[model samples]
Target: MANMYDHAYDLEKAIRESEEFKGLKAAYDTVMNDPSSKEMFENFRNIQLELQQKQMQGQEISEEEVQKAQSVVQVVQQDEQIAKLMEQEQRLNIAINDISRIITKPLEELYGQPEE
Candidate 1:
């Protein structure tokens, strides 16, 4: 029987070659290639990371911080290249989530699904 790790590697390779990955990569490249878009995208990503880190640390997110994050989201949403990149990213994330559910089916079957 083939090793599970080998199958996992194959899945990784397949994902890299998938259309969703290709679309996301292209969108990312377009955003990064332009100076203004690159800066805006990087700044937006930094803010998101900061908020996520704060939440992971169990710190309360201040109202000012929430407003700032919302403001940044509005700005990024208005940016055409960044908007496209975000849409592509969402598509890729959905595809990944679907794959994750499929891969975890065996464990779910063994343990049974949790009550909703």
Candidate 2:
């Protein structure tokens, strides 16, 4: 049964580690990626442990196991990176607005642009 269990681990690891599986997994890992979601991670960790145990055996996996795995993955999604990008965009917008404000300032300030 060791071989069987080994195959089970290998299969789970493969699916978990593969790029294609990751694309498929994005549906369930949103909170897990957040720095403040440690509880969410622990909660998902319990569910994931159950799933892994279910996976470690040759027994058929329940739909609940699959669902839990999907949900955990969703919790850990790469939202932080997206959030950082959004923050950068906001900063850029702010900088652009500041630049525009300066350019549109009183002509006396520019000593020019009093034309056009």
Candidate 3:
């Protein structure tokens, strides 16, 4: 089995290679570091990244990949004291997984559910 960090790294690579996430990150960083909007930047970037992850999941990427990429987001946004981002990330992780499972309901029933 892969360690979580290794899994996370792979996910990071996946996200870094994704054009959509990259564009969002560039916009997010701009929104964050701009002196004029520093206060709102963290909140907005967090939400945007959260939405990006959801978008990735809905596009048929692995749920685990989006979630792992999100944890890495914490390290990226730390200077903003936006530790709340970590909590939000975790919650979104759950939401994305739930959504993925919901989308696969037919397959799950056909193949039988895997052990949680």
The per-residue C-alpha lDDT of model 3 at residue 3 equals: 92
Q: After superposition, how far is residue 78 of candidate 1 from its true place, in Å?
A: 1.1
lDDT of model 2, residue 34? 55
lDDT of 2 by residue, 3-30 (tens): 7578767766765675544543452344
Which candidate leads in lDDT? 1
- Global lDDT of model 1: 0.97
Lowest summed lDDT across 10 adjacent residues in model 3 is found at 79-88
Order candidates by lDDT, high to low.
1, 3, 2
Residue 74's lDDT within candidate 1 is 99
Clashes of each: 0, 16, 0
lDDT of each: 0.97, 0.58, 0.60
lDDT of 3 by residue, 19-116 (tens): 54555555556545666445644545666677677787886556676676666555546744344433444555665577568767988798896767
Query: Superposing every Cα of model 2 onto the true structure, what RMSD results?
Result: 23.4
Candidate 2 lowest-lDDT run of ten = 23-32
Query: lDDT of model 2 at residue 106?
Result: 72
Candidate 1, residue 8: CA error in Å? 1.0
Candidate 2 ranges beyond 4 A from true positions:
1-36, 78-116
